[model samples]
Target chain A: MDILLEMLEKDARLTPEQIAIMTQKDEGDIKAAIDSYESRGVILGYKALVNWDKTEREYISAIIELKVTPQRDRGFEKIAEKIYNYPEVKSLYLMSGAYDFQVILEGKTLREVAQFVASKLAPIDGVISTATHFVLKKYKDNGCVFKVPEKDERINSI
Target chain B: MTDYSKKLSKTAQSISPSGIRKFFDILDDMDDVTSLTVGQPDFATPWHIREAAIDALSAGKTYYTSNAGLTPLREEISKYVKRRFSLDYGKDEIITTVGGSEAIDLAMRALIDPGDEVIIPVPSFVCYGPIARLAGGVPVYVDLDEKDGFTLTPEKLERAITPKTKLLVLPFPNNPTGSVMRLPELEKIADIIEKKDIFVLSDEIYAELTYKGRHVSIASLDGMRERTIIASGFSKAYAMTGWRLGYTLAPREISVQMLKIHQYAIMCAPTASQYAGIEALCAGDEDIEYMKAEYDRRRLYIVNCLRSAGFECYEPLGAFYVFPNISKYGLDSESFCSRLLYENKVAIVPGTAFGSCGEGFARISYAYSVKHISSAVEKLADFANKIKNERKL
Candidate 1:
């Protein structure tokens, strides 16, 4: 198992020294390894799995399914790029199953997300049609559980 | 008034209570305490393993299993031991127990005669000495050298042996110290034991968690297989400690005796857990890898933090603990731990909690979230610096 990557994946806040103890490796070695991973694009970036809903921050998220007409020699790549180029797009994936492309985006409100789909996404060349499904709530996100279950409040006895 | 002292057996009265328990009393009252004191993993049992147990329970597998535990579970254990460590034990030679604790107890009770000395390496697991004493055996403490990464030397092992020494308890991927015996180290010990008539009780509970290459079981060494009884289980590896599922593997003669004790006492390990154990052994390899990778990260972080705290920390290879020498601060293990707990609100186990040899050290566990460990390490460093500066005046 790659210990350094695992630690960063769970909580990127871990220092090199902390990672050294976890992997039984030296701090310098861990730092160097992390640097190497970073340079090689293995570790692209680190970001918090934020629960923005907890705060009063108003935002709406949606998963827009797009059925695109493949451009000659480009396939979905050409249209995927066009749709994903928008600043509102959070994630873009060429998915199997019912949708050829699943574009996840965030906007200030439902109206904003819908406006982006109608104005920005639908009008793109080779883009056949778009179906916007507003996400009402997220129970989980990116393998992290958003809603923490009620825990036993009693003291955790040793 | 009833004489409570008389009600308990002599051995029970003689055995000292765990040193870690008193700290718990202090901890319970304190709010916002960051503890690196627990020995168990912070990770939940993986979804599939839990699902398997749930399936078993829902299917009405609540009855007691056979005396040797569920046959399928035993077979899985047998296969796992052979596959992972290359130690051969037939399904008939394995007995599923409540946990590694039960297997250790069973081994001691089945082997120890009154006055028979059990050579236990000190500054390791706390249970070995007390359990051996309860079985009416004298515990011969062999203090391991921190300079050797707490690996038991042949000379020390030879010196501890006496005519009365009946069993040698080899705790590798050890607790508290987190020392692991490499193949050559095990080979050297095997050479000594091969000549001696004493049997071996090899507790390898943390075998799978070893990051310094795969764990080399003493039983796998030449001429050591016949005399060794390996006690390990799913608790540490599979995060199944709450299930209370573990097993013991020995030669037929020893396993048969251990099974008899287990049958009479535990009847069987929880049937649902045995079902879960099979799943753990069969399909839980990926989960082990996942948790191990996570622990490896924490292990590095804790050791580095301890070293930065101005303590001499020997990097632990196998288990989740980092034992750091705190003698430089001029305070004993207990006092340092107590002060750290009371002042900094960060709790760690004093090394003396493991054994007297652990006096100059403290065992800090990394089986917590990285955030928790990071904060605790900062507090520990602050506490150490405070004490160091105070002494400078």
Candidate 2:
């Protein structure tokens, strides 16, 4: 099972036959395991980690550090749910550091990202304060470089 | 008109042009051609390394320091080789050259005399044979078997050796095929080399790019260190191809001779690049790991795609290229590649460009983005189907 998950993690495009060959398991069994994993939510979904900065499309992402006032009954859960339910929120995490919550969100522009924080986020009940760190440049994200310089396309043999 | 053939050196006139250059000229004119032709890393030089070069230039550290390259750079290289590959050479034993290409040339020039035989395993890099010829040595070919993952076996080495055999070029983590020799494999080769009393030029430029386990240099084998000259560089690992910085680690006897050639033919490697190399050696381990993981991911993707498309791809353990056996399609490597280029708008290098043994195979590099590789593979599948259907008819 670990082997199947690892192979998929390395390359989601790997067919069950390829996995079977790699793990020396039956292709049908591999497929069944993958199906089970998906149904059980162990395998959520597959997505590409694209370097959008290479394209003409402008994408602005930010990691907003949030200090929230938790309700006595629900603790951080109720407020966290409200913040995460917003369309702009990409990922929400309960952090153990100085910040209580780390909310990773994205927008089309810097102003849009700022507006989401000021209008939607800051105005939420139990929201103590919000600090935003806009991604200026990404050297590497999710194990991919955004804009690697073009190397000489000539053959390097010899 | 003067017969320039008579004026030029015999060796220069005798050398054949690289087979790859022709396809490159054709590829240059074609539009929307997605290429997996070149054996270059698509990643840029990590920013910190590049920044160090920029900083050096800004500081006006432009003058050539010494013939053997800047001392600090040599020291860094010595430290790096020891740290990463577990091989030690004193600072003076290391000579930084203008890419691994120049280091190979320097070693060849230093070691080979007229009529000395140099054994080179193929289908490997193209340069080894030519460089061996340029040094007035006979380039003895030991064709690598696809069954053995293109690693040189003791039997092959023994067969290729002769009374006059002076050097054996060990090109593991190879170019066209991403074959890597593990420690046990290296030890076997080392034992044969030791018995034969020949020197080794281990080209480990792709050392940091190995996927399965860590790369083990043949020089690390006991008694082989004195007989091996390691040629590796920042180009492949740190993605600093344009920087033109590489180093050679050898015993003092060989280093002194190589240094003499380096001093005469090339005074020094570029100063700015030397500074960048220092930074790379000091803090480029993480970058190598990051890039290797990405390459490993892409390696699996490309190999799986090729296999699914009805090509037999030996799962490469290192390097970024996948040599898929295209023999099943009933076309030669060149014809298959050319047709793929012209008909399918995809460009891949013919395996014959590397050696005669590579006739029925093609080398596809996974250095491009996953999107690019996926599109190219689809086109390749289409090309394979067309050819197979045509064969059936």
Candidate 3:
């Protein structure tokens, strides 16, 4: 595994110099490698993982599963493009079972998400049905756990 | 209440309290201290292995196992030792211990007679000397040189041996020093042991964490198998310290003797832990590699950090600690550690806690995240500057 990518995935704020010392690499080489990774699209944008429940932010997120009928030649890709273009759509994945698409979306309120699902999502051609499930809590995401692990209760010992 | 002092065994009374005890109490009261004082792995037992124990509990495997252990666990342990270290031990030759502590105790009690001698390399773990004394054996400390990377050479071993020397406690990929004895080094020690009428208790708890090369067991060398009993556990290897699972592999005759002690004393290791041990030995190789790689990165990073701060640090070849030379700072190991804790809020173990020979050095554990290490090193560098400045006066 490329330790540079691994470190950046864990904490993108680490400077090239710090990564060089951690990985025992030349700082110049680290910077060059990172630059190439960024150019090659392997290095995506870095963002903070925030818990909105702990903040003053007012929003609700929902997973809207849509059953789609594939257009004769276009298949599910055309429907995926139409759903993902909306500003409220945070993430979308083509599904394997029971449903044709899984759409993770955010809206200002429960009513907003329901309205989008009912009026906007349901009216789309080749979309058979929709089910929206609200996310009540997030214990973990992207390998970053939200719960502060039980404070290391280990006593100092041999 | 019962006049315990007068009635207690003299050897037990002679053992002093740990030197690190006071600092630990103070650390508990003080918040926001980034301490590198832990001797166990920082990672939790991987979840799948824990789930196996949960399954075992659900299945009601609650009865006491055989005196040695569950047959399946012993078989797994036997297969594991053979697969990893190339030391073949049948299921009949292994005994499940409460922890490596109990296994070491078992080895000491089963082998040492009254007034027999046990050769111990100093600056190792704190348990052996006291355990030997409790078993009515004399503890002979062999001080290893820091310049030698704290390895016990053949000459050192030879000098420590005596007519009554009945046992040698060989702990390597050592805890405080992190010095691992490779095959060639083991070969030298084996040559000397081949001549002597002595037994060996090889404590290899940190065997899987050898970063430089594979760890060589003395038991694997020629003619040493019958004489060496390997004491190891799941604590260091699989991060299962809280589970209290360990085992010992010995020659058939010696194992029979050790099993008698374990059967009488412990009855058996925790039944659920034995079940978990089976899962760990069979499925935890990837966990070992993953944790070892994490330690290796922190090892390199912490060594670089300590060296850059102007401390004379020994680059450890194994284990998760960096034993740095702090004698030049005009303070003893305890003083250096306390000053660093109070002044800089970074807590590392003084080397002397391992043995008197660990004086003038401190063991900094790298079993932590890189972020934690870097933050602590930042304060340590500041503290080093303060010491250097004061010395100029």
True contacts kept of each: 0.50, 0.30, 0.67
Report how far off residue B197 is in candidate 2 (Å). Answer: 2.0
Interface RMSD of each: 4.2, 4.7, 1.2
* Best-performing candidate as measured by lDDT: 3
Give the TM-scores of the predictions, in the order they appear: 0.91, 0.81, 0.96
Q: Rank the candidates by DockQ, best first.
A: 3, 1, 2
- Per residue, candidate 2 scores C-alpha lDDT tens digits across A43-133 of 9999998777878998999999999888999999999989989989999999997989999999999999998999998988888889999
* Candidate 2, superposed: residue stretches over 4 Å from native: A1-158
What are the per-residue Cα lDDT tens digits for candidate 3 across B266-289? Answer: 999999998889999889999999
Please list the C-alpha lDDT of all candidates, in the order they appear: 0.86, 0.89, 0.90
Q: Sort the candidates on TM-score, descending order.
A: 3, 1, 2
What tens digits encode model 1's per-residue C-alpha lDDT throughout B280-361? Answer: 8899999998889778767876776677767798788998888889888899989998999889899888888888889998
Error of 2 at A133 (Å): 12
Docking class of 2: acceptable
Q: Judging by TM-score against the true structure, name the best candidate.
A: 3
What's the TM for model 3? 0.96
The C-alpha stretches of model 3 lying farther than 4 A from their native spots are A69-74, B1-3
